[model samples]
Target: MDLQLTGRRAVVTGGSRGIGYAVGRALAAEGAAVALVARNARHVEEQAARLSSETGARVIGVAADTGDDASVAALAEAAVRGLGGVDILVNNAARTNPGSIPDDDLEAEINVKVRGYLRCVRAFAPAMVERGWGRVINIGGLAARQSGSVTGSIRNVAVAAMTKNLADELGPSGVNVTVVHPGATRTETMLDVAGRRAAASGTSREEAERRMAASVSIGRLVEPEEVASVVAFLASPLSVAINGDAVIAGGGTKGPIYY
Candidate 1:
């Protein structure tokens, strides 16, 4: 399907790897000019160059920490300058420090997830409003619903609320804001978590992964492209009416609600 996204300018945070990288590739496949943002300069630039070569899209990379206001502002400026303007913003950067308990340093999680998201949105949304068209896809997580033992559950819940609030605020300005909950995707983080669970259960990582997969209705982990495809669709003209909605890309989460 032609998503009618050719020539659209997009910025994706944490675009160096995992789901963010997949999302960037998906957008580029639709012929959109993409700017990749990540804290690691070399990795981000390398990925951007590779994507540009592979997809033949105008792909640029900016090294900036989303947790810092100055860095986020600079990233926004760089994206607009590089892409001519920003038509889509994918707030995909997130941190899940399971070791950090609530009583410990909650600030670290807040700084990276909550503050970082807000900073990027604040820096980029005005331009979208001015142009009168934009798509903001926030990568939320299933933790928002299950709030399991994961340390990032609180932050995910906050992100879900922020997604709804931003969708409401930006909807009137011709910007569609939506959140996606990609549950148990095959990413580095997921593998690490699986290993941890395996150690805790005195079982192999593969076995632990299998157990986790069995918990889902589809009986398997989600693929990064599955989530990315949804993101691309949401950014495309096809989903103009899907604002303020949280689409769960999980393999039918273990819940009564459709999610």
Candidate 2:
């Protein structure tokens, strides 16, 4: 499992922490030079430093707001200069604010993940196409496959549609584009959610965690690194076979078979 990723360059949005950080670590471990992009400069830099030290890989942090056009343009330039041209772009930066059925205003939130992802892909994918080699793994959510939040479903399904279209357009150019749907990943945000659940249910945080984990078919919530492992593979040349597909990395949902 060499992944054949040595010397390959990668750009990961939302790399300051959580799932993005985990993906950075995994990619670095597989010997890919990475640019960690996030809005918080200091936080992203610190995480980059740690990942670089641990994996002995070239990892750099670039601060930028993906939802902003100017910021994303600057980000693409910085990534090119840092990693020496992006061979892999992981669109993992997203806003996870929940919306209601009546939905007051989710456009801004949805735009950040949907439009933000599109911005990053637009900025970087062309270069990959020119080089005739690239991997674009867009992070979606399980809501896309189910019916719950209207906004969530819309955005995630939008990502899937975008992936298929990109794959169709880029396949001839050696660029593989795909989307991943992760449900209730084990991250700091999940910890915050568990804490809230604990307070609301008047139970211990540990109990809340168990309750949340038990809801999954795997009998536990999937770790960030677990999801990252999938991204890392999808980010490599080894993943040429999975283009335009939606890989679920949420430790499997309880019931409802998705094929």
Candidate 3:
């Protein structure tokens, strides 16, 4: 249960809330020094302070838009400076808006999800290479396996491909790269989504949530902490067995046979 992660330094992007926040909490709970990254300076810093106070762990917050290269570079620099070094990088920053092939928002989606992830990995992986040990856990989605939203499918699949390629590139240096795909995670944002669904379905929020939960095999939505726990494990030394793999953390993902 130690995870051998005590004192390990980690940087988690999009760490202000949702799965990102949960990931930071999980990592800190495991005794890792964590620096959380988000686009909102005030919110991220507040969450950082709260986490530090609660866990008594070294935690700092940085605000950087992952869609920008220069910002991500600065993020890497600041994170390394704050944590003394980066042993783990969690690529969790993303835009959750639903897109369509006809909508043709592919370029923008690629920028935020695919290119942004690559940017973070590029910025931090070298340090891992230099230190000869690192962990990169890319937050992907189950849409990679499903076929409905082209934007989601492309972005998630792209992240998975990038993770595999990075694992090949960094595996010799003792850096393990992996991707986690979570579906319909239960986070604060989910409440907002549920509220909208309630309005559209002419149902109560509770009923909307229940309908959503019924779609999952577990009869409920997956919690952010559940996904974060998987991510935390993947970010640890104990995850050496799972390099370049996609671990789905969405309440068992209902009846899909994925090899």
Leading candidate by lDDT: 3
With candidate 1 superimposed using the best TM-score fit, by how many Å does residue 252's alpha carbon deviate from the native? Answer: 0.9
Error of 2 at 171 (Å): 1.0
lDDT (CA) per prediction: 0.88, 0.89, 0.90
Q: What local lDDT score does residue 25 receive in model 2, on the 0 to 100 scale?
A: 93
Off by over 4 Å in 1: 96-103, 199-202
Candidate 3 Cα lDDT to native: 0.90
Best-to-worst ranking by TM-score = 3, 2, 1
lDDT (C-alpha) at residue 31 in model 2: 93
- Could you give candidate 3's per-residue lDDT for residues 31-140 as a string of tens digits? 99999999999999999999999999999999999999999989988998999999999999987563234448888888988899999999988888998899999999
Model 2: weakest 10-residue lDDT segment is: 96-105
Residue 221's lDDT within candidate 2 is: 84
Preferred candidate (lDDT higher): 1 or 3: 3
Write out the backbone clash pairs for model 3: none
Residue pairs in collision within model 2: none
Candidate 2 lDDT for residue 24: 94
Q: Give the better candidate number (1 or 3) by TM-score.
A: 3
lDDT of 2: 0.89
